[model samples]
Target chain A: MQIAILSGKGGAGKTLVAVNLVNLINLSTYIDCDVEEPNGKLYFSSEYNKKDINVLVPKINYKKCTHCNKCVDFCRYNALIDFLGKVKLLPSLCHSCGGCKLVCEFDAITEVKEPIGYIYQGDYKYHQIYGGELKIGKESGIEIISQLISKADKEKINIIDCPPGNGCSVMESIEQADYCILVSEPTIFGLENLKLVHELTTLYNKNIGLIINKANDYNNIIEDFAKTKDISIIGYIPFDKELAKLNSNQQLVSDNNKFKPYFIKIIEQIKQEVDL
Target chain B: MIIALPTKESGEKAFVSENLGRANYFYLYDTKTKEGKSFKNNFLNELHGAGVKTAEFLLKYSTDILITPRIGEKALEILLETDINIYKSTEKIARENINDFLNDNLEKLY
Candidate 1:
């Protein structure tokens, strides 16, 4: 079964939950969908095999001779600007929708591939792992993520560490996943953002469970929220200083026995839900 | 006037491109008639998506100046040639402080 770990906001310990879950599961393929800032690879210290991926952008051939404004008018992204009877092509704004190419009577427009980001594949002892990294100053993070997930070895069970926020990246990561684990803190902002993520999951019609990180004084609030939403509280990890210290030293949560039980419990719950 | 604010979030500081290192927002404030508006954009995402070759969505709105914390060489060069005044300031809310700079109520923060 494919499981997607996500949070509506950043720095909400999604990666922490993802890495630990991967280590606890019997065997699973791991994917880091946060192309902008993929820190999941840091947990396993796995050597990644890098591969570049490209996105197609529109290229105009001026030699085709017709200076008709049809191409400009057809572009919804304002990628084509017609000024003084001259057409200017803005490749960046181009979503490569092929509308301009399709509209141009004279075959003046064609698609050209542009480098966007890289996908890194590696192994964490038993699990095959893949993550994506968007080139600095590059857009289309969701595109990179989609490509990376497509390349995931489907033969094995998958765990996707989703990008933060309820934007395009998060949507692409969990698009077709079998289940979703919404990792959140116990604060008010955490609950609010978790609700946003829950709403998104409901929209996708995906089964979801919650993992409350830093479980402390806010347990009652979290439990109440879970009960009202009918979302299962899979597991909770207490605020542990040793876990924080290990993380600061670049150690995985699985390396600490104190945190292993929480991960194991979540893994067991996921297996039961998915009937794995 | 329409001003550009390079922001980490939606609303924040208006940074000047020529000065400062890291600014939350690159705000574009109009000094002519005491009317100020900020254009908040995700600078990292914009730069990543467009690669500084073209100013499509960025230059769509009308603006006289682009106040940013720090703009890369490519974006700065492109915006400078477009006849836009690029100012550098550390002040977060430059619209409120335009009068301060004019009246000497605020010194150049950067």
Candidate 2:
């Protein structure tokens, strides 16, 4: 089963649940779809085989080209600019739609692969972990996430740690999952944002359940909201200083003998829900 | 010549906006008539290529020059395709800057 762990807002324990759950579950493959800031790999030590993720961009051959300005007018992105009777290519603005290539009569335009980010494939013991790292200043993380999802082994259980927010990147991650683990905190802000995640899961018709992290004095607020939304409460991880200390040191509570049983219990409940 | 100045407000008393793509408004001043108008820059919130979109928007005014704090390389390339020239605005009110521009006191930004 492919499971995606996501949260509408940041700092609500998405990484915490994803990493620990991946460690708890057997025969699991972990994918960190948070390309902008992927910290799930920090919890486990593994050497990554990095590969560049490239996108097709236009390259112009001005020798055989006439200054017809067709490609310039055809480009909706304004990637092809008219420069003194010649066409100038701005690769940054190009969406690689191949409109310029189609409009060119002289066959002056050609597509070239440009690197947008890097994907790291690493192994944690017998299981596997994949992390996508988008180059800074590049706003396209959905492409990398799409590439990551395509590389998933359908035979093994997949655990995806998605980026925060309800943007296209998060949608791309959740779309590939058979089940969703919606993690949230016990605050008004958390509840408000959880409503967005809940609506998204319902809209997509994906099997989803809620896991409340940092469940301290505000448990009633989260539970009440989940009850109203008709979303099942899978489990809760308390706001413990010891766990916080271990997390600060880049360690997983699931790796600890004492906390392993708690995660196992949650996994057992999830396996039954997913009909595994 | 119609000159476009990035401004925070929609009037002569407005200070110049620092960034062209993210400016609140573009104040247009006609050198011959000394009349001014303001256009709300709707491209400020765009995730990408706001500069190019803003430059495309300025084409409607037949603007002869642009006076802003700075323009990006992409925006400069786009604006150069038209007749609009770029000039850097200094620490002065919008009205005074327009006067300085008309009097040829401001330096061309190229």
Candidate 3:
């Protein structure tokens, strides 16, 4: 079964939940779809295998170009701009639809591959993890994530750490997930974002369960919200100083079996829901 | 008066500008005239050094000056040479709040 750990906003313990769940599952393959700020490898201390991923961008040759606005008119992303009879290309905004090159009457535009990010593959003892790091200031996160998912080993149980927020990256990660684990805290912002993620999950028709991290004074509110939404409460990890200290020391929660049991139960619930 | 603000995407409100330290979008506000316009270029894409020419294209819209959170020294020097005032911004943009910015009430937004 493929499970995606997601949150509506950042800093909601999605990474924490994902790492712990991978530890609980033991043999599962992990994919970190949060290319913008991939921290999954940090907790696992996995070896890195970097693979450069590139995207096709439009390249204009001024020498052979007529200053016609054909390419600009063909570009739907507004990546091509024509000003004062000069043609300019914005490679970042270009989705590489290839329409510009196809429409260039003078053959002024060509497509070129530009490196956008790198994917790192490594192992955490018994488990395999693959994560990507987006080149700073790059916007092709969804594309990079799709590439990661395509390379995912479907035979092994998979746990995906999805990017925060309900943007294209999150959507792409959750699209093919067999089950989803939404992690959130008990704070007001957490609750609001939890609901937003829930809405997105519902839109994607993905089975979802909730994990309330740092269950402290806000447990009641989180529980109430879960009950109201008719969502199942899979597990809760209390706010413990020991866990914080261990986290500071870069220790995985699954390092201790006692703490690992919670994620084990969550994993079992996911297995049952997906019939794996 | 036309002013340019760097935005996450074009046609969206400027959340952070190049002068702003780190924000979602940037807005260029013209105080003398009540005109607020956002420059559409994906900042994340620009960060990858992909659309530098596109950014330069948007820079043409700046009639007088620009307001950002924090700009790189290189971009700062380039804008400086163009005779555009680069001021730092500390607030997000909304449709209504932009008019107040043009009327010299930018301090209230922050």
Chain A TM-score relative to the true structure, per candidate: 0.94, 0.95, 0.93
The candidates' DockQ values read: 0.08, 0.24, 0.08
Q: Could you tally the backbone clashes for each prediction?
A: 21, 0, 16
lDDT for position B22 in model 1: 36
- Tens-place lDDT digits, model 1, residues B1-110: 55454443333333233332233334444556545454433333332323242233346555554545455554454555566555554544555445444555443212
Error of 1 at B109 (Å): 18
Selected candidate, larger TM-score, 2 vs 3: 2
How accurately is candidate 1 docked according to DockQ?
0.08
> Per-residue lDDT for A150-249 in model 2, tens only?
8788888889999999988989999978999999999999998998888889889998888999989989898998888788888888888898889889
Over A1-276, each residue of candidate 3 has an lDDT whose tens digit, in order, gives 688999887877888888877787758888999998887888887568899988888888999988888887667665676643567665556777789899988988888998888888898888988989888756577778988898667787788899988988888998888889899999998888998999999898888889998889878788898898888988888888888778666679767866777777777777667765
Residue A134, model 1: Cα distance from true site in angstroms: 1.4
B-chain TM-score for every candidate: 0.52, 0.94, 0.55
Note the residue pairs that clash in candidate 2: none
Model 1: CAPRI class: incorrect
**DockQ of predicted model 2:** 0.24
A best-first ranking of the candidates according to their TM-score comes to: 2, 1, 3
In model 2 chain B, the worst 10-residue window by lDDT is B52-61
